[model samples]
Target: MSSVLLFNKPFNVLCQFTDDLGRETLADFIKNPGFYAAGRLDRDSEGLLVLTNDGQLQHQISDPKHKLPKTYWVQVEGQIDSTAIDKLCKGVVLKDGLTKPAQAQATSEPDWLWPRNPPIRERQSIPTSWLKLTITEGRNRQVRRMTAAVGFPTLRLIRTQVGPFKLDGLALGQSQLIKQTNLLK
Candidate 1:
């Protein structure tokens, strides 16, 4: 039987199970052997990270061809307006290329959120706002770049959901085992 583990990765933790640099990794939090992360969450970002023992399941989650929608709760450095939101929805051109159209909207900070260990820098002259964006493709720092391209640099990024799985009910650094069937389309 295949086993899936939904982890609420804490900020500053590496996505990999092992690290040569002595950085905090999934191994520090998860002891389950033989499971690997489906996709990577940057050390600076935090939230739901899926791990599985099945290669097929891992591929399905990580492959861009699957077009599994990943939702991010991004806190940006400026007061995001509807125009910015629209631009993000329409897609933004980055150094790599134009990104696929994404679903984006302004939102209040999530109530269930835990404070980052070292909180984001705050500028008294500038304000910040939150946005929820769902994108089908996973590019390197794509969400951060997309927001910056629209003139709102991302201060904090959290992946709240990936396809059918979510970070709902999970606390920081917590993990729960789930059946693979729960992730089926």
Candidate 2:
């Protein structure tokens, strides 16, 4: 039998269960004895993270070959226009290569968005809007970098879903044991 854990990772919390630098980590939230993260979420980002005790299950969930789409609700520092959406959907060119075509659309801010403790930096002359994007690949800082590449730097990032699982009822720093029976193709 395999076990899956769903965590609503809070902003600035290291994704790792352990941290050598004495920084806050998943340990502060998750006390499961044998579980491990499937993929890492950056310290600045928040929302759904998956963990599993089995190596093969973890690999299956995180490997890009599975084509599991991760959805992110992004607040960026500018009015996002259709041009940006078109570029993102067409696959923006990055230093590495052209990113796989992704779904990018502007959306209203989510209902339960909480204020970050210290909050994101704001410029007197700049404005920002929320956008939702879904992508199949998980690259280091990919969402932030992709948005920045199109002249809109991400101010806050919240991953809302990974495949069929989501941060549905979870709040900041909350977690629950998710039964494998609920997993979807």
Top lDDT model: 1
What TM-score would every model get versus the actual structure? 0.97, 0.96
Which residue runs does candidate 2 get wrong by more than 4 Å? 181-185
Residue-level lDDT of model 1, residues 1-185, one tens digit each, is 77889999999999997899999999999998889999989999999999999899899999999999999999999999999999998889999999999999999999988999999999999999999999999999999999999999999999989988899989999999986564655
Candidate with maximal TM-score: 1
What's model 1's overall lDDT? 0.93
**Clashing pairs for predicted structure model 2, backbone only:** none
- Across residues 84-136, which tens digit of lDDT does each residue of candidate 2 receive? 99999999889999999999999999888877876999998998899999999
Model 2, CA-based lDDT:
0.90
| Candidate 1 Cα misplacement greater than 4 A, ranges | none
Clashes of 1: 0
